[model samples]
Target: MKFLYIFTRSAYGNSIAREALDMALASAAFDQEVSLVFAQEAIYQLVMQQNSANTEKKPHLGVINALPLYDIDDIYYLAEDSSTYNLPPAALVPQAKALSAEQFSSLMSSADRIQSF
Candidate 1:
């Protein structure tokens, strides 16, 4: 089965972002096909130079970087949101692809199961 994780929250200030990553990793470990979509403020998770240690929050980039190691490389973010936030694709981690709204919808429609955070 294919699993799609749609993340729309900021990486900090809450546990949902980390919990979503955990679920994706666990699903991949079980040999399920998993894909991640970062939308809205969740795109903040892909930005570089995050210093969450000062806030006592766990940094999310490390877990994001490990996605490829677990064979979970299909990471995407919404281009509209990125532009709205003035975040260029170059400013984000290399593993993420920026997709248009139509493409994002197509990808979401292809998933067998969807989980939104």
Candidate 2:
């Protein structure tokens, strides 16, 4: 089966991003093709410089950064969302592709199932 997981939350403020990451890893473990899409607030998770030192929350960058080791390489971030949040695509984690709205829409259409958070 194929799974497209869409996450739209920030890494530090909520559990949604972590949950989606875990689900993606689990899907990959089952040998299912998994695709990850980061939209809206979720785009913040891929930014290279996140310092959570002042906050009481921990960041999920470690988890996201490790996806490639588990064969979950088809990760994408919404280009428009990134632009809306003022995030430059060049500064994101190297493991993901930044897709335009049109490209992301095409990806969603190709998925067997889409789980959004």
Error of 1 at 108 (Å): 1.3
lDDT digits (tens) for residues 1-117 of candidate 2: 879999988887877677778888999999998999988888888988888777766666788888888888898998788778988877899888989888888988999989998
Highest lDDT against the true fold, candidate: 1
Cα lDDT tens digits for candidate 1, 1-117: 899999999898678989988999999999999999999999999998799888787778899899999899899999999889999998999999999989989998899999999
Clashing pairs in 1: none
Q: Distance (Å) between predicted and true CA of 83, model 2?
A: 1.5
Regions of candidate 2 where Cα sits further than 4 Å from its true position: none
The per-residue C-alpha lDDT of model 1 at residue 68 equals 98
Worst 10 residues of 2 by lDDT: 52-61
How good is model 2 by TM-score? 0.91
* Residue 70, candidate 1: C-alpha displacement in angstroms: 1.0
